[model samples]
Target: MNYPFCIRCGWVLALTFASCYPGLAQTPTPARDTSFTVYSALAKARKTDPSITLARPAVPTIIRSRMNVPYCTASGRALQLDVFYPKARRQGGYPAVLLIHGGGWRSGDRSQHVPMAQQLAARGFVAVTAEYRLSTEAPYPAAVQDLKAAVRWMRANARTYRINPKQIATWGFSAGGQLAALVGTTNEETRFDSLACNIGYSSQVQAIVDVDGILAFIHPESGEGDDRKSTSAATYWFGSPKTERPDLWRQASALTYVGPHTPPTLFLNSSVDRMHAGRDDMMRQLSQFNIYHEVHTFPDAPHPFPLFNPWFSPTLDYTVAFLNKVFSRK
Candidate 1:
């Protein structure tokens, strides 16, 4: 189910880190990597205790969701972003989150994450759900580039939007999670940088939140993606399978770029999501890099569980805690 579940189309959604530290002049390259898979983590935990309690559901929070705000122009197309802003700020401008939705880089829309964004806003962050060019329009780096352009556009207009550009984060779900991870991991690498618009401003983000995104296409976890003849979404995004164009998959893999400077990251994943390719490796790399990171796994949940109820509230709680911890850092 690429589309998010609408438990309450009518239902709704803070923290303040403003005026604490100065922001960056240019997008700073952060060192970053990955570690154990959630499944492995679960196996290890259950080894200690056969029965582990499921996490409690978090209460819902609502905020004002503003839709269809134009953020950038890419390849002659206007990219739009939906913002979820906290109704009131703690003091200065609110920290921003560049929210991305997922659909295997083939199908999905910014609207899928509207509920999560609204909750984040109510929690005191200015969250924006960005639209990107899917594989249908463009492949591989195009979506990544579009997202980078969106970040720059958001930063450029931070003042008008009452957001703190310095405090911006990249948060994505599923395929969007992969893009968000790429956006965070790639940093200012010119290879992933976009010339579309807002080129002068930096797209560096302080934190990354990935919700069950596939981080590595070349990893065995994706299943049957190495064959060029197959029609997997990985091929759609890479334009070819790993067997034909290994470089493309390697270059696009978020796991490939993890370094010492990768920003603080948090992942919310399902216990059975093999779609989360390279998670074990990425987490290992992050641990090796000694970066602050965390992952919470939901037992027997679906890939799209974060967008549904029962799981929805707990997912929001996990998200709010992670973002607050990262954004509040001194």
Candidate 2:
């Protein structure tokens, strides 16, 4: 029997790097001869572990294309965010998670992240997916502003969502990882704080999960080779090529933001991805600050293997454990 759950209400929310529509649960279509199948990972996992139960409760109510009130972007773009929560599980306030999707900040969808959000929700955390402005529509700080606004909106609506507000965490992939790191590091400054400050929301994240993201000017050999096609994501995010935008790149880099006050973080990288640079540098920074973090690297996997490879179930398993550990800290 499926247990019904409640839809959160009364909170004003924004989409930093999410969609304007309600979240949708999608099953991968069977297209023959494709390089990959959405079900391939799940199927492979179950084959190895027959005890796995793949069923998930239907999202009680998935919201879509809803505008974040008091839009935070300078373009006045009607930003949007999607929420997924269990209907039957409301005991006071719950832990909330924000997910940012990767597409070089040029192409990607909030729905692509719905499964991850659902996994968090099933494990008893409120999960949200966001959409941000792309380079085609706006450049650099535009997307950053949207991301900060989304965090602000969550804090603003904490009461309505039944979230603790203080327990919120963030996760992102690739370009989204950079934005997540930016949000994690830049809390007091309001580069996008046009919204009212009286509400008392800060863009700081309590913990962050960075997947296959760059952490320093130094790369892990893969991301350092070609200038044009290889490092395109970094080039676009920093608004200039790595050489021309050295200072700007460092400023946006998470490695530059470490401090005693920085939030705990978990990092994932693959040996094959060109963007895997700076994992060691990031570890050093974390050690210097004495900050808390966990690192996982897939030696033979391709870039983004964590998102696509089911062989490394440890990625999500460790992530859930880490979230519990950090969020429960009082």
Candidate 3:
């Protein structure tokens, strides 16, 4: 399979450097590339070389989510978000989409999702890439709480942002997908009050789009490190050993929140099975609930095919179509 050229370049550089330190004569190892990709979306996703970047869809305007606009506040730091919208205004404002980035719930920034938000904005949706606390920053439910607060913050200030609160949806990739699903399924049960921002607006989302996120984190065939208990993301993000906190682990799963009233969802997946543990079950549940849902599988694609070109167009099409249909019905 053809990979991004940037990855190939990184390998060449490493090999060249290795040859320079001939015979291991106590050569001091040069500094490692710090800003390279880590575990984003799926742990199996190949680490990207610095040059590779997501393709941006052309748009008339570029908007920032604003640096450190506290969706919620904590002793350490405040949560933030990035907003992207069309330059031309719509009559009744634009339908809002909150985008969440993936980094195995441990590492990632809202900046990674700007290209996607721009694409969505190009398609006429007011999109915001929401930031939440990482596992390193806090732990389970902290990220979830931050995301819920972000929704509330957006809805509470819909008029100022020219948003259609009734048509808001949560869209996330990989780990973010897991959070998005949680947000959609548990819309009826949980919501965090926006701190120092919107106080009373509801955090409920009308639709959801999960791009190859972990559907169930407690599966036997857990993807990353050796097993389920050892999987860095599943274990680290829970902030406990899986064996000791099975109940809490399950509670944190997106599939656990699935219920009769879960909003219409669109799931897109790569051919990889590592991250898509309980997709069939989630789909079955959605079908049984009679909720409008759709699933698409990209053949032989890697962990995050949606973020790049060639496949990005199709991915964007499915997302836009699903959002338009579901939001129109609402």
Best by lDDT: 1
Candidate 1 on 228-312: residue-level lDDT in tens? Answer: 3435666545555567678888888889889998988898897656757888889999999899999999887666666654577
Off by over 4 Å in 2: 1-74, 89-92, 192-200, 217-231, 309-313
C-alpha lDDT (0 to 100) for residue 222 of candidate 2? 31
**Candidate 3, residues 149-204: lDDT per residue as tens digits?**
88988887777777988888999988888888888888877443334456568888
> Each model's C-alpha lDDT?
0.71, 0.61, 0.70
What lDDT is obtained when candidate 1 is compared to the true structure?
A: 0.71
Clashing pairs in 3: 65-82, 65-83
By the lDDT metric, which is better: model 2 or model 3?
Answer: 3
* C-alpha-based local distance difference test score of model 2: 0.61
Candidate 1 vs candidate 3, lDDT winner: 1
lDDT of 3: 0.70
Q: Evaluated with TM-score, which candidate comes out highest?
A: 3
Q: How well is each residue in 224-265 modelled by candidate 2, as lDDT tens digits? A: 213533335444344456565467666666677677778889
TM-score of 3: 0.80
